[model samples]
Target: MITLSGNTIYLRALEPEDLDFIYTIENNESVWEVSNTQTPYSRFLIRQYLKNAHQDIYEAKQLRLAICQQETGETIGLIDIFDFDPKNNRAGVGLVIGSQSHRNKGIGSEALALVIQYSFQQLQLHQLYANIGSDNEISLQLFTKFGFQKIGIKKDWNRVNNVYKDELLYQLIQ
Candidate 1:
């Protein structure tokens, strides 16, 4: 398992033991709304997703991490480095704070910073991109705060709550 540490937060690989925490967050409607994931996630589905991720990890195709509080050691969120392009040294990033109590605590930013450093330094990735829903102001602001530029927008990219919504694409070139 990969581990990253920061002043206020830390990240480690999501293990089978963390599945319950993941389920709690994945099933939350508020988390799914901004994350473009379906709510009321079942254990079977999460297990399937984890199985796929485990396979990818074995193949060295992806890096999926669980974000947690350094002091409490509580699993609060997840981060992924996906869509890896080795030739271009780039990858796509996604993050979700599953625990409502952890929201707006600077933990997410800390985790993002640590992961970006890992992606660029350890993984030798030259760039990273994040795609967020247009209406997700907090996520947009968070990424922007990390120097991610608004590259473009995809119209009607996601169908949420029975309505089409735009997706804002942001990129960070290291």
Candidate 2:
């Protein structure tokens, strides 16, 4: 099993025990805009998803990892590689720190660094990209800090609250 350790945080594989934590994050309406989540997720659906979490990334075409605090072993966030295209050697990345209390801490940054290293070094991926809403300045900054460059933008890409917002495309070529 892969365990990415940082000074203050670590990334680990998702487990059945993460059901409740994932449920809370998935159903949180406040964070839906960034995730493009329009409907609430039921516990039953999440439970089924958890059962399939063991599938290898190459077979599943996606991977979601739990972000944990180093000393206390508390799961504070999730980092995902979605829309993985092994043939193309690329994938889309997404991340979320479940609560506002975890925001602005170095946890997210460290988790992202570990994921990038794994994607490029272990997975032998050529590049990683992120689709970020224009209003998500924090995420944009976090990704950009890791050398992800703005590649393009989709105008009116996501609709939130009654208005459409632009989505920025960022890419990091390894």
Candidate 3:
């Protein structure tokens, strides 16, 4: 099983049934800045994505997992290991809790913990990285809590609404 579970949340591979949840999140204009998404994704495209979700991390060079609540079994967010480099033993991590109501509830924290362990112990990865907007205090706090240090800042990296914002690169090494 690829599922990683914690007390509050679990991370599992994307499922065909998650089309609606993933669709809504991918098309949310408000979160485009965080996700670096510039356009909406059609259901047809998303369905195609789900069909390919079974590809292993090595084969796909990326993995997207659904974050679900342990109690309710409700899928609430998504987490990813991207830019996987088996030769270098590293990958990039990104996650989004689809709803504001679910933020700050420790769900992301638990989910991140699972990923860190899975990456380091299971995957034997040397490091993981995350790029975060400088203005995102919640994400800054969340990533820092896990000992991800701010390695550098990319000035004017992302342009949102005609304003260029700085993006911070954070890294964690096992």
For residues 48-130, write the lDDT of model 3, one tens digit per residue.
Answer: 99999999999999999999998998999999999999999999999999999998899889989999999998899999999
lDDT winner, 1 or 3: 3
List residue ranges in candidate 1 displaced over 4 A: 1-3, 48-60
lDDT of 1 by residue, 113-144 (tens): 98888888888889999999998898998999
Tell me the spans in candidate 3 whose CA falls farther than 4 Å from its real position: 1-3
Task: Write one digit per residue (lDDT tens) for candidate 2, span 1-174.
Answer: 344788888888899999999999999999899788989999999999999999999999999999999899999999999999999999999999999999898888999999999899888999999999988999899999999999999999898878999999999999
lDDT, each prediction: 0.83, 0.93, 0.94
Error in Å for residue 68 of model 2: 0.5
Q: Indicate the TM-score of model 1.
A: 0.88
